[model samples]
Target: MTTLAPTEPLPRFAVFGAGAVGSYYGAMLARAGVPVVLIGRPAHVQAMRAHGLRLQTADFDERIAVHADTDAAAVAGADVVLVCVKSGDTEAAGAALHPHLGPQTAVLSLQNGVDNAERLARVLGRPVVPVVVYVAAGLEGPGHVRHHGRGDLVLAPFPQAARVQAALARAGVPTTVSDAVPQALWTKLVVNCAFNALSAITARPYGWLWAQAGVPEMLRQVVRECVAVAAADGIALDAAALDADVERIAHSMATQMSSTARDLLRGHPTEVDHLNGHVVARAHAHGLQAPVNHALQTLVHLLEQGRGA
Candidate 1:
């Protein structure tokens, strides 16, 4: 539980899987004068290396210069590593980072799915903090990240949680260290289970989906199913609060499409298997039924298979 002194230098950050989410945060930190290195795809790395990362938001559009590389070895001297890869790549990302991480490097899982931190920790044989990310962003091109709305993070308490929070705060990234992180993660999971598949299946945004006939009720059913599964797994979720958050998302990010929707549109594999599919599996493991979640998961799988489109 060590803390950074006020006179201490800023921690160096390395963002692995520098896609939309990673690029956004790394750009923010780099804009604030913190040293950041983004390790990502060759196209993105080349673009960033040549022109820098272009961060487009409602407030500003600017290209922030930051170190960019396609090699995992770029993480060697980083003090903090943010893992933002898709859930399917969590293990591989960890394995790739294993040899590069220094003894004092703190790893944070900024991806979706509650089990990612646990899985990554097992892979790295070190404690990995789990962060619940709430942001609406997408990649417009190789080096460009378009911010739709809201960029905040909720993290479970750990030894380096305060330090990480402090670094992000300096970069103007809103962050919280919450004792109820498991509950928060479950709440976020419930929202994803409710909206991601529906948005992807319909290729619609949150406001439109919520405005559709019976969509609100369907969302409720999905949330209820997720709550039951979470309760069985010993996490109590406030359904009313979750519903309120769903409404907030609908209003605030009305124009933003779910990441799954974007993925399907790009002909890329969606993380539906980690979102709704995870719920369905957990429900089954608990001898419970989550029909709505199962149906959504099935539909998304079909779409992924190029059947439903």
Candidate 2:
């Protein structure tokens, strides 16, 4: 196994949301005896403060000792900060955490979108590492986070990444450091941009969504447009593998509704803008047309408007 150089004192880590992804990672680190603080909402923070973080997965359910705070002060003096907020809150999150970033602190965007790290870095005027998180998990309740499957990170290379990467791996979260991280990011982006909105808009599981009489054809079109945008952005990808990945999701998580779907159902804003909307914007910049992604974005926005009504 490739391992990162160890850092002494095991850096103080902060997670911006104690939601599903954030809680899982934070719980692992805390279990491994690394100091981890989770900054999140009042209910989660209160529950965690009283009983630590409750984590549920295929193998176990236990309360891990994680410092949970509703206060942004949870980020103070941290050596590594993982931005796990929803994509829409990226800018505000950066601003709120800016005062807490130490000179040597490393910020990593561990969210869904490909552009979050760049966006957050620009807002905070700090280098932010982009990580593609391949995990399917979510909050089961206020203080409880449930993991379904797949927990791995492919992080963009950064100066202090070796130390951070190894720590994460040691805490039971697998980490892969890659020079081709952008390719990985864009690939995930393509998959999400293609499927998430449709799943959310229809409020159907992947299997049901694609299994619709003509939905598979529409999905193929969406994937083609995303591939075109990726190519225009100079990203090399395995077309077959990408298609296979989409098929795998429909098969493996057939009963699963997307996070976007759950969010919209719960009346929370979805990250359609950063997902499909991102492909549209990037394609425009590259002088390529991404009609499929554009249409997907528009449909999701319409759904959002309907929900707002």
Candidate 3:
């Protein structure tokens, strides 16, 4: 893959959150000679500004220079804005950048929830493309990101999608733009709903969770409820295929903690609400009940009650 040459003028890219996902993509883009600026938490911004962003993956570990700031104004001249904040921060992040977003700037939500793009669009008064993120990463430290697994994205087809996909591909970020993004998002959500809560609650990895007795049945029920909700929401999920996919995920990242698990471990609020809670809400909207999902969401809430995000 060929990336933009240093001498070539390319579109400016801005990442709104410097968490693992944001840092990884921004660092990769910068590695490809793209002009990338990052806006996020103070410590991360300070670390990045002082030295550079540290990227650690199984294949490679290196530091790459990329502009970072705590100020939203950093997004002013960006041609593309990547929204990588947690689901709870979608609106706040969008509002923070609203006044600075140029009309031509394309927004992409690389968040967990299925509705983040829709929520961001409403807040920004513009369209925001949804991307199904398939990566396992975490903020190892300030300005440092550890990528544990996959680094690819599945995006919805749009006018600018080809350009974005090409740019990402050249940056060594595998991407696929297709019309089936809605289903793809739900599929990923299903996987999260099945594993995130269990892993987070138990403070264990996928293998540990799936090894427990009765765990398979429990995960199956969660997947069933999620599939029902997805079906109600106009996407018919294939049970067998989804289960197989989840199994593959569990095996592939057997030792990795879920994002929810990492959030809780770090004393930050988890996004179980957007994961299982979304299923509960939509299930209620459709005159259905998702007891398993409701229970998971409630458990996470209880676990996070005295904790601050």
Candidate 4:
């Protein structure tokens, strides 16, 4: 962990896949005087180019001026690259970035799923730090992002982690570099396995889903299955702690929809394959069963198929 001195200049940042999560973090960094370039869809890039990014949150609503582009080449000179693409696109994103990354460039995975960093590393042939993102956010429209609640990161310890943490901290994003990132990531995976699919299938928010009959027990079973899968994968996770976290999310972001739910609403593909589906796959690999997670994954896939019809 290399600490950034007060006199040292902030690193130039490139946010790949600048959707809701990317835009929110990039806006925060840009607002704090850090140089940020957001790579995203044409509509979002065009809108930001025309009139900056509109960031709406409970604390404040403001337009943040940041560089936005649709080209991967925009990442050429970035010192730090935040990979925010979905898990399915991790390798593609890494390959796209390979040609442009400098020798000292640090890539960080801000996407969900436990294996993203490893996948990206395989593609880039470089060390990619895994980051656990805990934020509820959504894109209201082109160039506009609405933050529901919480904006913090837990990063796997790496050479650049401290510098990245300092930069983000200056931007008002709480960051921690931990040695137990594998366990932390597994914990988050368990929570995602519990809620994301259920919320997406029901098209309801966390609080509403948690309020339904048998929903809490259902969530617990999902967590249990995920924990067993994690144990099989050699990552020890506390089931009780994960359960409490699931409950906390229901209350804390009561009105917030999961990213999967938002994706389904927009007719975009959800990351169910990476969440519950991943758990099921890993469970099978370990000669174990994750029935609850498998059921959720199957239901979400059915919903996706129905929507496509």
> 1-309 in candidate 3: lDDT tens per residue?
334456655778899987999999999999887788999899999999888999998989999998999999999999889999999999999899999999999899999989999999999999999999988788888989988878999888777676677678767899887789899999989999999988888889998787889887888899899999999999989998888887787787788778898888788988998999999999999999999889988888877875664
Q: Over the stretch 1-309, how does candidate 2's per-residue lDDT look in tens digits?
A: 646545566778999966788888998899888888999999998988888888888989999877888878779989899989999999999999988889899999998888888899999997999999998888988888999998999988888877787788788888888998889898888788767998988898898987889777777777888888888878877777777888888888899888888888888899998988988998899888888788888888888888982
TM-score of each: 0.95, 0.95, 0.96, 0.96
lDDT (C-alpha) at residue 67 in model 2: 87
User: Candidate 1 lDDT (Cα, whole model)?
Assistant: 0.91
How many clashes show up per model?
0, 0, 0, 0
Ordered from best to worst TM-score, the candidate numbers read 4, 3, 1, 2
lDDT of 1 at 26: 98
Model 1 agreement with the true structure over 1-309: per-residue lDDT tens digits = 334587988899999999999999999999998899999999999999999999999999999998999999999999999999999999999999999999999999999887899999999999998898989789999999998878999888877677777889888899988888888888889988888999999999999999999998888888899999999999998888888888888887788789999899988888988888888899899999999999999999889899433
> Which candidate leads in TM-score?
4
Candidate 3 regions exceeding 4 Å error are 1-8, 306-309
Clashes of 1: 0
Q: For candidate 4, lDDT tens digit of each residue in 217-271?
A: 9999998888888888899888898899999989987886788888888788989
Better of 1 and 2 by lDDT: 1
Residue 42, candidate 4: C-alpha displacement in angstroms:
0.3
lDDT of each: 0.91, 0.86, 0.88, 0.91
TM-score of 3: 0.96
Stretches of model 1 off by over 4 angstroms after superposition: 1-6, 307-309
| Cα displacement (Å) at residue 253, model 3 | 1.7
